[model samples]
Target chain A: MRDRLSFYILRESPIHRMNPLTKLTLVFSLILLAFLGPVEWLAILLFTTVILPLSFLAHVGREFLSATARLLLPVIGFLFVMQSIFLPGGGTALVQVWVLDITLENVNIAFVNATRILTMISSFLLLLLTTHPSALMSDLARRGVPGPISYTVTSTLQILPQMQVKAATIMDAQRARGLETQGNLMKRIRALLPLVAPLVFGSLVDVEERAIAIEARAFNSPRQKTSLVEIDDRPIDRRIRWGLILVVIFLLGSRLWLK
Target chain B: MAQVTINNLTYTYPLTEEPALREISIEIQAGEFLAVIGANGAGKTTLCYTLSGFIPHFFRGELQGKILIDGLDTANSKLYEIVEKVGLAFQNPFNQISGSKFTVYEEIAFGLENLGLPRDEIRSRVEWILALTGIEDLAERSPYALSGGQQQKVALASILVMKPGVLVLDEPTSQLDPIGTREVFQVIRSLAHSGQTIILAEHKMEWIAEFADRVLVLDKGEIVRLGTPQQVLSDINLLSSGIGLSRYTRVAHRVNQQKLWPKGQRYPISLQEATEAFGRLLSQEGGSKK
Candidate 1:
């Protein structure tokens, strides 16, 4: 397992320096424009023109493309293939196979659907890569988000990796004692019980102590909490955020107007 | 003036019949280092929680009587308000980590940020605490990626940065190795010497004997003995109560029983005192032989 669950890659580019909220707004705008805009191939257009270029500007172009290929391509590819064969609204058949017909209309619709999903995932992946989770949570919390909600999001990002490490340790320990974790299905299933019990109970106890620990740090203090890292919401960031919002509104509104 | 005052305090945890602490009363002066020693289930942790305002505020227990910090009733004050006056660092350094912070520097600043301090103030305080706890080099390191000892020091620094008037430690080194335990004790010893009002629950009797201004021994859920470390740590009855004496005191007791030690002399609680007493005995024997 990866040592950490965060997608953030630290770099000194303009995109990395953008306000987290602005980047978040950009991601949401791209997604809405792709899925809800009144234009065919808008998803593919946004992927090539906006998201892909932004990834390079952020200096994570290589990582972004690899992540998209590794993580998103398979899911989108599967969806495209499955929907092309199974979706029932196509009229013109492009090819015939035994008892099934691959229709041209179905292929077109699946491509559109797949590109929309690809655009959505890749945009979000770009945001995660550029902005640190804590910085995002801090900016959100500063903008009047509830403290506990922000805390839950940030802490989960860190805790998941620690939990994975703990699980691995427990698995190794049980294996050393001759617990059959590798063989057939039943053996692996039985091995899971021993591995799971300690992790769950141990974590539950840690939760109690953790709750006390944070409270001691005044986590629930009824005061305006400040952040140590100052996330700069520059004038350019503000303009970008407003521009994204307007674009999203225009896209959605024009789609409604056209309909 | 007493910085902490507990009067006839009793507390039972939620869903439990037995009170974790019962009729416990004590007055601790400001800047005094008070050490608490007890066997398992003897309410050492419970007392630490009580002092830190967790027993009634966080645990939601059946609390009777009063605990006052700087004359502020803990039962009336909010947990946050109490936390401002008393900082608590417990065992299990891993669990004590806020987990929200990525770096050791940010982790220590977590408490200050919660208090709504300015960014510059938070930075200065965190930097100061990192140096004080001797984890300045580990400031940029991940809080999760540290040895148990380093994590424990980070935990202590996180609380210390708040500059709480009273520091409550509940067996802070219980989960550490000997090296880790010593590292933690060194920090605590320095804090004690700086005259921080500290109430530490610990099992390391030798360290307590050397550093604690007074020692309080608890049995079950009540205080059985409270006095200077020399008076309380050397008490023979503490053995029957299951609170073991320091090794020096135990050896002195054994030798006193054999009449090798001076009659009615107090048992030594530290290595330095033990060495002096033994040296005096050997010299007197040598003079007699000559």
Candidate 2:
């Protein structure tokens, strides 16, 4: 059922071989750069060449772009309106739409903002897809992250599909009880109530239970946790991680001094 | 010999006024297969949980007395350490697994890895368990893709990979259909044959009659009877009282009523045994007529 998810994750490719920390660092750097860059198409263009290709390089393929666009499209509409309508100034007033003016200044701002949003979302998607959640959790813990925080982060990915299944189980069970989710809005909500309530309640209970499951698995042991997908401290991997940190510093320097 | 001693154990769910279990005490051997049976609200599930360290730990409740697993009190031991000795594959097979990205193979390895076995050892043990459960082919497939029966096997395999000596189940096949039920029993049969201590709480007594070594009848959170299958099924009134009689035994019971067989004698636990016993009686009657 989830075969493709398993297939794509935990593979021994060079990208998967790199440390998740390194990937996390790089993605954070990319998002920071995207945030700090000038609201000019040229900066977006320059960043896209460096940042966007990393998704493909990490083996997510063309579907990566579609996934990013899918996630960003709804976000873009809200941000676009904000930049267009709520901007402090306008180069030239083009038209009035409702309470806001459409101006060339707003148009330029919207484009830059949308591109930046897409950049952040895409970089995150690329990094997470290559690294399994357990490995990521282990890496975070080894880096001195607290167990509860790391557990909350990793186990959601672990527990989400379980909740998803629980929801479907509820749906099927409710259907058998003669509830129709495909009906009117009220009926759909009514039908959904049985599914949602139990799932939420069950998940709340599961959090407590999973807390023990984690502890029972030695998660609370004072000894350090070892990842099954152990990343050797390769020179190349170290260099890449240090390199990303340096890039973030360089960009921070550029943003401060070059302005 | 390792033994589980329950001394004056009583449990009450926090919101409820009535105690689910009342002053229950029983002892089970280290590698014993004890099948507990009772009607709904009979406290059968509660007994299983309390005995296996899930009652006070996982479920919030007022628990009285102590549950000692192999002389180690559950109250004193950590759940993870206890879990290493006792594994529960929950009845809802799907929710029991921790991660979905793991294939059938990785699902089995998940718990084993947590137990900190060496890598090669984990590999061989996973392979061994997949074959032991007879799901080696399904190793590479996602857990979501398998049928209810196959997923249950994968779930069992995952728990078994840790090689926990005792396995407890709460109506493992209740969710499955007839065929799935049969397949689940087949896996359980093999596990029992391999000498794993199996504690199954089931309402379906026919399969339990054929498979279980000992039957513990729980009625209102008390052990009413503990005996061999032949000894327990022999009494019609006792069987119906709360023991959850098997289908074949019920049939044998009906026949006994028609003929009024010898009183206080044993009842049949299986169809074949019933047929043989009835056949012997019929042959004796014919010989007397001749």
Query: Quick one: best lDDT, which candidate?
Result: 1
Over B1-290, each residue of candidate 2 has an lDDT whose tens digit, in order, gives: 55667888889998998899988877777667788877778787787677667777777879888887767788777666677677676566655555523466766776655566666888888889888888889988867667888887887777777777678887888888888889888889998887888889887877888877788777777778788867765557765565557666777678777875555657787877878877877787788899
For A197-257, candidate 1 gives per-residue lDDT tens digits of 9999999999999999999999999989999999999999999889889988988898889
Every candidate's chain B TM-score:
0.97, 0.92
- Runs in model 1 with CA error above 4 Å? A1-3, B257-259
| DockQ of each candidate relative to the true complex | 0.75, 0.33
Residue A221 lDDT in candidate 2: 41
Itemize residue pairs with steric clashes in candidate 1.
none
Candidate 2 per-residue C-alpha lDDT over A47-68 given as tens digits, one digit per residue, 9 for 90 to 100: 4786566656766756577777
Model 2, which residues run further than 4 Å from truth?
A1-16, A37-43, A56-61, A94-101, A132-135, A141-195, A198-225, B239-243, B260-264, B285-290
Top candidate by DockQ = 1
lDDT of 2 at B260: 53
